[model samples]
Target: MTDGEGWFVVNACESRWRDDGTLGSYCTFEGKRRFPHFGININVLGPGEALGMYHRENAQEAFLVLAGECTLIVEGKRRPLATWDFFYCAPGTEHVIVATSEQNAIVLAVGARGRGVGGGVVYRVSKEAARHGASVERETTSSAEAYAEAHADLPRSRWVPYREGWLPSDR
Candidate 1:
């Protein structure tokens, strides 16, 4: 579909979205102009190239694999994703995505852009935990814990315990 107004076809060879070795294109309708609800991007992850696990403060993301194979590491569980596979990373969920095969895999990623307010918020743990490389851990009750403590009255508390279903490795 080609329209002279309010529509644009972004060439895949040139895209503004950061690429972690992923070949793809995006059609930004209202882009940043839409603020919280932006357009969408199609990503083609090359072999051995996987997106690192990270979380946004407020964006809720979802991905659909159009071709090839890949792995989705949401929260902490790794799930194989082939063509026609869809994955969702709701707001506050710490997650990562990786390409599993030698061939490139195409994936469509969409999400809302906004400030995050929830549990999965990353926080600095104890010196021991930090020293031992405990990395991101469940909040127990510490001065630092107060920093990344999931926001008060989060609507998804009941699901926090089962966050492992998404992440590659649940802490």
Candidate 2:
């Protein structure tokens, strides 16, 4: 939906998840068509699911937990996160998010984008991430090399509507 003056608006329910079940699910906003300075996406993770390999990128990235709970593995440290928690990863901060709650978790992610913002990402091995099956055994600058063994298809998954006032339990 256009905002009439270049701004675009879209509900998460309108976007389908990509490559679901293999790890986590994500609905990437059409930033290329609307916003040019940044990228945005909504990530959904089920219990024990990882967001992908532990990696760091040249562009700064941030996340806001919209629902449920998850574990943030960053720089070899583990941080438990719940709904409404926000996380910021400066450029080159190795990290990955894994769902720890019984229910699915949703995260709103944003990242810097523009000229000179290299899209380079390097995968790293982290003991904390290894337990979640997100760690790479070796350092690699190529995503192809980092995920060469992955076989998940890139088809879009069915979209699920978010429930109103859904908050994670205080467990």
Candidate 3:
């Protein structure tokens, strides 16, 4: 549906679920329209559960928990998030969400479908290193040490790897 389409409101009970068990309710313009800007949805996952690790090739997303609690592992750090809590994941960040409460967990996720134009969005498993896999290393190094680590052929400088869409253009 068009973003301007009077905010297509839907109750959790009214949405459809994928075979994998995610209740997916689309914005007013899902497949009902030819081409839409992006997709938005509110997901409800039962207790002792989670949404696994999978990367979005062309989208950036933010998950906001409305009820219950969950552990979010982003690049290897586990952070607990409760109601009204939020997390924004840049594409390829590698992350995951696990519902820790016995009661159902409710989350609102807003995302856009576009390449780096949208940004990085990845999920890591909250507790399982195997499920979440390896992580990036952050070492303590002095500026001179960091500079010396640069490739011999390259200029002597320390530059962070650029992930295409982590920040808004104007920012």
Candidate 4:
């Protein structure tokens, strides 16, 4: 629902679960609009699933481990993060999050959108990110190349029709 020209709200559970291949399932309470200037989403990651390619961007990004455990791989370092843990990625700082617990992990991600040209983002080939299939084999700015194995490209990944029980209960 919307109120005024610039405000809206939707329950996280009511939003559709967008599956971005190896990135697993997620949702950004937006429907069919030009990608929001400020992006936000809740990622539902199964064990071994990752948030996305290990890459840095010209824009800053932040994440919160809302539930479950995940390994945060940043610039080749692996750090464990659990519920309530928050992480910040400064401009040009490479990072990726991978669920490491036996169950699942829920991460709330927010980032400032960058313009579409001149290195808004760059994918990196990191052994640490590869642990969960979140790294590219070659350093490039192409999302398609970085996620070729999983058939994902940000331009084409977003909201979809909702599915029942998209979020599994904690085990």
TM-score: which candidate is best? Answer: 4
- Output the better candidate (1/3) by TM-score: 3
RMSD of 1: 13.3
Over the stretch 17-130, how does candidate 4's per-residue lDDT look in tens digits?
A: 687655778887766663557788888888898988899899988999988899999989999999999998899898999999987798999998764686488998899887
Clash count, one per candidate: 11, 0, 13, 0
Question: Could you arrange the candidates by TM-score from highest to lowest?
Answer: 4, 2, 3, 1
Candidate 1's C-alpha runs over 4 A off are 1-5, 9-36, 116-171
Runs with alpha carbons beyond 4 Å of true place in candidate 4:
1-4, 116-119, 152-159, 163-171
Candidate 2, residues 58-152, lDDT tens digits: the string is 88999999988999999889999999999999998999999899988888889888525336788997888888888877888877667654434
| Model 1: worst 10 consecutive residues (lDDT sum) | 157-166
For candidate 1, report its TM-score.
0.53
Alpha carbon lDDT of residue 82, candidate 4?
Answer: 99
Model-by-model lDDT, in order?
Answer: 0.49, 0.75, 0.49, 0.80
Which regions of candidate 3 fall more than 4 Å away from where they truly are? 1-12, 22-35, 54-58, 116-171
Candidate 2 vs candidate 4, lDDT winner: 4
RMSD list, candidates in order: 13.3, 4.6, 15.6, 3.5
Model 1 Cα lDDT, one tens digit per residue, 1-171: 233435565544333444222222232333334534444766655674444323333457788887778866555555788888988777766555667776766677787654434423453333332322232454432324442323233332121112111222224
